[model samples]
Target chain A: MRDKNLNSKLKNNFGAKANDSRIYIFLVIVFVIIAAIYPAFFTSGSIKALVSTSLIYIIVGVGFTYVMIGGNFDLSIGSIINAGAVVTMGEFNRFYKIFGGVEGGDSALIKAWILAFACAIGVGLLIGFVNGFLVAKVKVHSFIVTIGMLTTVAGFVYTYSHGNSISANTYSLVDVIDKSFVKIPYLEVFTPRFVIAIILVVVFEFILLKTKWGYDLFMVGSNKESSFFAGINTVKKVWITFIISGFTAALGGSLFAVSMNAAVPNFGERGIAPLMFVLAATIIGGTAMLGGSGSVVKTAVATIVIQSIFSFLISMGMGFDAQVLAAGVVLGAVVFFESFSVYRQGLKEGERPALVLEAEQLRLKK
Target chain B: MSSDNSASVVTLKSNTGKVSFNTIANRFGVFLMIAVLLVVGAFASPRFFSGANWLNILSAVSILGMVAVGVSFVIYCGKYGDMSVPMVMALSGVISVEFMRYGIVPSFLGAVAVGAVIGLINGIVIGKLKVNAIIWTLAMNFILEGLIRWSYHGTQIYPDMATAVTYKTGFLLPLMAKLDPNIMNIDLTMRAENFNALAQTYFAGGIPLMLVVMVIIMIIGYFIQSKSSYGNKLKVVGSNYDVGNMSGIRATTIVMLAFMISSICASFAGVFITSVNKVGAFYVGAGYDFQAVTAIILGGMSLSGGRGNIIGVAGGVIMLGLITNILNLFGVGTFTQKMISGAIFIVVVAVNANSLRKLGKDDA
Candidate 1:
């Protein structure tokens, strides 16, 4: 009897390990497919591009991973990106032109870059702070509150743009933004935007994994009741997660706009596509969607894989719509497969006959 | 000693009175917002009282109203409301248009059937497999959108030339002919069809069909949500699955039924939308799902599930129409209207939360 109990425990642990390995194997397959398509995809320039895009997603995903892992949802990430892009672009254009040597010269670009960086990061933090306040302090469900924010931000974007694109030429900062930095095997890829994205990811990742506050957040997310019993400030942790989600999304939006050289109302409008992809990857990385376990590294890797698949699909003569469809299918499949175990478990304990039958059938097949 | 114990128990009950009221009110808060908005709009806008504007508003709301009715059921069943409403709508519309060349009946039936199939898939995933409704439904939305895009490739189909002339121009011919005849009148710079009709056609009389259909759907929703055994079972299951299971309620079936209702409503909404637009595309139902969600929220429905009524959702649809109409009267731009709408939505939700909090405190 003792031996049987020990064996069952071992089997359960092994099943979980097997599940984790399945996701990793799937991610590796995606990477392999990309490499098989284009040798150049693995080159320095492509790597830089891939890393840059991944960096944006990774930053945003890190914040959202906190919320999702913590057991909340935010639909406002897309809108936050739009809001972030508008803020960063507005600042870059306004200051860059003022400091442009057309009025003064080379020194003007540097000054504008510094100012743009500050504003972008500041705007992100501000949005994050508001999201945190509303969600944690006011005790509103993040989903409903975020949907409202989505519409508000979308409206703001349209209003701020005056229904037109903000051109890069208007702000002479376009020149400084286009300048790329090469750092041997790995390009530091210095754009005022790229630099900010890297710094935010590194700093935020540290705060999430290495700090007491992050641990508190993890505790609160894992179980509010237990956290409260342990004297953790659960509400504060919830607030912090929302804030971080908003800030990171905003920062990502700004970087994307800076790279594209314009802030259109539609800029980051479809950011949900990338956001969902990041979510799938984060979940696939063994980060519990029910809230508690997540890794910055795993999420970063997933982001890269997603971006590579997108680029590869585009290269294979797929249009924007097809690319989106393919990505969605891939994401759905991954999540479905990843959560299969939990789903199977739910069925076994469930009183529903249909679910029980299905579970039995699945077991038989396996 | 028994009498003394009774007195303390009464005091304890009184102390907890505040919480019950708060909880109940929070559950019905969306309905309150809808009522308040409609009342405010009716009084504030003179044009709102006109028969034609009312008809127009109802016509505009029919699509979203139908979809919201479906989602409310899903919420009541305890699963996250399916987010594939837009895709389902588009699917039905696309299929309808594809088969329109055969006749209206074939097109309509085909679309409805397709919608049913989609709902079945949703049911299977959410009910049987127990996939997270949000992700599963969202994924389904992508697949539908992709299928539509891939099939249509952005090419939109217009009504048959004969149908176009007969159905569309027939209504306008009398007005157009009258305008041409009166062209010589100095005061008739604008045609009667254009100017006189715009001012005079304040009430559309030929819309009983849509109104009747809308009421019928609401009645059905009411029956399913409030009166039916299935409905009561779903509520129990949603409130607490363990309790429901103990009662022998089939949780998966209730969930599946909810998804089916949502899909059917989405399909019906798409049919109405295709009628309104006279064409369908990938973006046909793009924003409709979100609008329906907003209506559900506005109707005092809880996102967490287990509490809502069709009457509330109907009131919500009416409120949404009134808000937009009122804003239009003030010459608000689309962007401004969106901003105001979003602000109002958030405020309503906040108010609901505040009332609930107050109730909680009172109970404590």
Candidate 2:
């Protein structure tokens, strides 16, 4: 009996590992299919561009991964990105105006950058704190709280900006943002943004796998009641995750401004395409939708997959509508298949039915 | 001991009077807010209490009320309500307008049938297969919006030709010709004067037919949720799926029915709203999902489900409409209106959480 139990546990770990690799396998298949149609997709230049475009979202999505892995939703991240973008840009411009010299120099730009960064990040932390306090401390549903935050923040951003785009003084931001300290073997035109994404993935993935805090966070996500009973500070852990989520999303916002040199109102609008993309990417990255587990590296790769899908559809003469539909179709298919596979796995395991186990647990609780 | 506890809960003068206060805040907050808003509105603007403006507020929120009532059922079933309501509304309206060549009533039926079909898809996937309703419906929202944009080439569908009214060849031609219900007592500009009469027609005493229809739907919803066995099954399943399943309730079927009812309501709202605009576009249904969800939550209904009622939901919807009207009278901008509503959403949800915490319960 002990041997059987050990073997099952081993198989479960091995199964999860296999599933993690499955996303990359699927991504490779997608690449191969695209390569068959367009040889240029295999070229280094387009690959670099693909990573460049997905880089910002990878930052936002990595933050989102923290919240999701900790078992929470942050629908307000898109709005956070909006607020961050607007604040950083608006603050940068305001400071730039005050500090501008007849002959522009780096010192003035550096000052603006520092102030802008502080204000932007401060705003994100504030919002994240509010979301965390309400969800963790007050115990409101994260979904409802974040939805309200989405609207209220968007309303404020719109009110402040008057629904117009704010363009910033870019040399200071561009010089720092565009610098590439690390080089890849094959990719010649790699940017620092790509490096930042890789670093975030590696660092966070390590923390999640190796740290006690990470384990507790997952425990909380898996079973909040049990985690609480086990003496985990579930509320604190959950609240901290929201802050990280907001922080990363806000970081992405500043990067967005740096890349575009502008904070456009479009991101905060109802389309919420960025939020949708991150959500789709996170789930596609092999994150368990019911929480308890996710991989930062896989999420990064998933971002690439989505970015490729966007280009693939566009290259095939499909319009923006096709791209939108494809997100829905792909997300829907993944979720449905995940559920189906779970159902099939349940039957295969011949374990007690989930409902029966749940019933038993309820009785125990009572 | 139970009677002593109840007596304390009932009497404000009791030692733990705060319990009574919390009970009222949790249970009757929406109704109280509606009453307060009515008083505040009369004070804010002379037009607020007038018969004509009151009718306008009813008309303005009629579509929203219908959708919210349906969403309340979805929330009651603990599915987080349908996120695809906006898309469903837009798609159904567009379908109705596109199929007008088949005659008016058939077109309406066909449009509503599309909604039912979409709901069926949602039901099967989320209910039978046990998928997450919020994500699935959100995906459906995207797919439906994409389909609309793809089919229409990102253009709004008009009523055949600049809405040029023609002498109807059908049986009701004389009635439509004599009465352009577009001009009937509503303050809204008749943008769709020649579009359709079903949406425009007013009942006796100038009560818009749409308001009447909405009230009837809410009444039916109240009965179904409060009185019907189906509703009891829904509450049982929603509160605890395993318990409901073990007790022999058809949990999947109840869930499917809830989704269908929600979609059907969206379809009804779609037809009415599309006629008002005289054009069908994806953007037309853009904000209804959030608004309806807000209204449902504001109605003192629990998002975790199996609590609150249709009457409270109606009060919630009316209160929203009333606030917007009062804001309009106060000369506040639309963005400010949204901010206030959004802020209200957060406050109300926090209060709701506080109330439920006493039972050692937390809503999703």
Which residue pairs clash in candidate 2? none
Return the DockQ of model 1: 0.29
lDDT of 1 by residue, A244-336 (tens): 787788777776777777777775334236556666767766677667777666676677777777777766787776666676677677767
lDDT (Cα, tens digit) per residue for candidate 1, span B272-307? 666566556666787666677678767776655676
Query: Candidate 2 lDDT, tens digit per residue, B1-364?
Result: 9755654455534344455565677688888888898888988988787899989999999999989988888999988768899989998887776546445676679778999999989998888878778778877887787677766656676664423434332123225445664422322223334346667889887898789989999999999998999989989887888888899998889999999999999998998888888778887877788788888877888888888889889988998999899999989987777778889989888888876664445545
- Provide the lowest-lDDT 10-residue window in model 2 chain A: A1-10
Task: Tell me the DockQ of each model, to 2 decimals.
Answer: 0.29, 0.50
For candidate 2, the lDDT comes to 0.80
Highest-scoring model, DockQ: 2
**Local error of candidate 1 at residue A6 (angstroms):** 7.0
TM-score of chain A, model number 1: 0.82
lDDT of 2 by residue, A94-130 (tens): 8878888324587888888889989989888988998
The DockQ-derived docking category for candidate 2 is medium
Candidate 1 vs. true structure, TM-score: 0.83
Residue A15, model 1: Cα distance from true site in angstroms:
5.3
